[model samples]
Target: MTIVNLDHMSTNQLLPEVQKAMIEAVKKNYGNPSSQNAGGEETLGMIEKARASVAGLINCENKKEVVFTSGGTESINHGIKGVAFANTDRGKHIVTTNIEHNAVSKSIKRLSQLGYTVTSVSVNDKGMVDPADIAKAITDETILVSVMHSNNEIGTIQPIEEIAKITQEKKIILHSDAVDSVGVVPIDVQKLGVDLLSFASSTYYGPTGVGGLYVRRGVRIWPIMDGGIQEHNKRAGTENIFGIIGMGVAADLAGKNMDKRINHLKNISNFLVKELPNYIDEYHLNGDPAKGLPNLVSFAIKYIEGESIVLMLEDDGYRASTRSACATGSLRASHVLMSIGLDHADAQGTLVVTSGMENTKDDIIGFLRALKNIVKTLRDISPLYRKNQ
Candidate 1:
């Protein structure tokens, strides 16, 4: 069976160029980046090249601001926890949205246990958090504000720049979990006005297990990991050299071909949105229709569980997701869906579809056709559908 991946948010296939780069790096078998020998110096050069490339992708003015990590989770943890620990003398209060990824939420939760105060501002029905709400949540004790650049579940892009102004005026630090946004969309840290931003290589066709955290010059942040002075002392331990090389190639390609890649993704996503009604009924679109990510579509199909549909679609060679892959296997209704005003039933029935540069319009059409049948099969036996009927 030919599989169509509509779950790009979870695992993006590495680009051919990225794969080749990784293969080449492995063949070379370079030395450690920290050593002073010629082999180590060569490895260091390659690492620096990757850093510059990744920095270019996010428009970080100084490449030194970029610190490599294991992935998005570590980057977020470093950004949130590091800043929180470093700024404890200033305040123990933090601001964030209700729809943040688990990395941000759990980090803040841990901090709360350590005597820190938190104010989680809620988003509107469309999953867009108001800048005013964020401002209102801020107080004199608020030291940092960590809002995701784009929501993983619904794909709603937040107003980071507007919120950045508030943080800037108040002399508070701002961090953005841009794991899902950095490579999928154009991200300029300078323009976004964020002191710290976390991103993963997998989001941009790079290999998994390698990511970066952008710490603006002079930001008060401590290293989450302690040991070597690698990553400018922001992160410790040996780097994932193979993955970093792949990420560098992927980042460069993403920067040079972003417009073309986005166009491809937008075409398929737009087709899915425009044709969804023709294939299925009794469904509501989630997220801001006009402002969400160009490559993602979320639908709340009534009267059936999303997992049932996902499994049934998989049998038909069409893969879909019910929520963030990181939150998979959890029986609880999505906090993100609930925060966007979705009731229990609709939230449980939510389906998240994401496209990639490799996905085509026909792929989306085929998936929709498969989904229509699956939804019918599930709803035919659903007690909710029967009662509603």
Candidate 2:
């Protein structure tokens, strides 16, 4: 039985190499990284090496600027909340887009509850946010601007570099949730000019429980967590030694093969774009195909449920997602699709297919065949389809 995995954005399978690294980290260097003993020093070296790998993948100039965290959610919280709490005197306003991942959106919502003002700029019909809107949203009281480098749901790549210039000109802080972009795209924090960036380890086939936030050198953001001196007192707790080691290896490996992986994703996704719409009538691609992430292809079918399609794919041993994994069990329609001007019915029929390193052409064809059949069967029975007919 050949099973095609299309849900890599939610999580990734741990690579064999990453597993080996994690084992070596625990077995050979299992000591508290904070300890002054020799084992601790060895453990510290391993962790730093991993940090360097993450730095290399993201083109971060200094490893110390990378602070380890639990995962993407935590990194975003630290970056947004850290700056919001630390810079209240500077300004109480923040700017972001309407289509941010739940992490950034929810974090800003919390900030608003704390009396910090928030302006959620809108995205155009193509699912792209304009730099002009971001600039317009900024004001004297605006202390920070956060944006996603690339959207996970629709694969729309935001203009972070341009937005960064706006923030830099005003001396305001810019934070990017690059959890979906760091391992997949060529990220150079220097070029992006972002003050803070967050990405999860699992995005690159590393362990699930670890990730990091890159706080550009000399950026003064308050610590969200406190108790220990870990993460240079920016975050405090015992580090996930094994997970860090695995993430470091994954980051290094991603840097080594990023071009190859990206090209593969594009090739496969292009195939999907050309053939997918042919099978289902009134189906539309969701994002800007040329500029979006190469790995993801999302679409909407008329008068159908996304969940039914996902379940049918799963029954055939393929995995797909209707929305972000974080939003599972919530019956609400995707906010992303709605923001891009999709009505509730159009958004309800949304289907997202995200490619990964392991998928083959045969897998793609098979998935498409199954999808066409399922959509036909579903629409054939749908009362709405009959009424429209």
Relative to the true structure, how large is the alpha-carbon lDDT of every model? 0.93, 0.91
Off by over 4 Å in 2: none
TM-score of 2: 0.98
Structural RMSD, model 1: 0.7
> What TM-score would every model get versus the actual structure?
0.99, 0.98
lDDT of 2: 0.91
Candidate 1 has an lDDT of 0.93
User: Candidate 1 lDDT, tens digit per residue, 242-338?
Assistant: 9999999999999999899888888888888899999999999999756889888998999999998989989999888999999999999999999
RMSD (CA, angstroms), candidate 2: 1.0
**Best candidate (score: TM-score):** 1
Q: Which residue window of length 10 is worst by lDDT in model 1?
A: 288-297
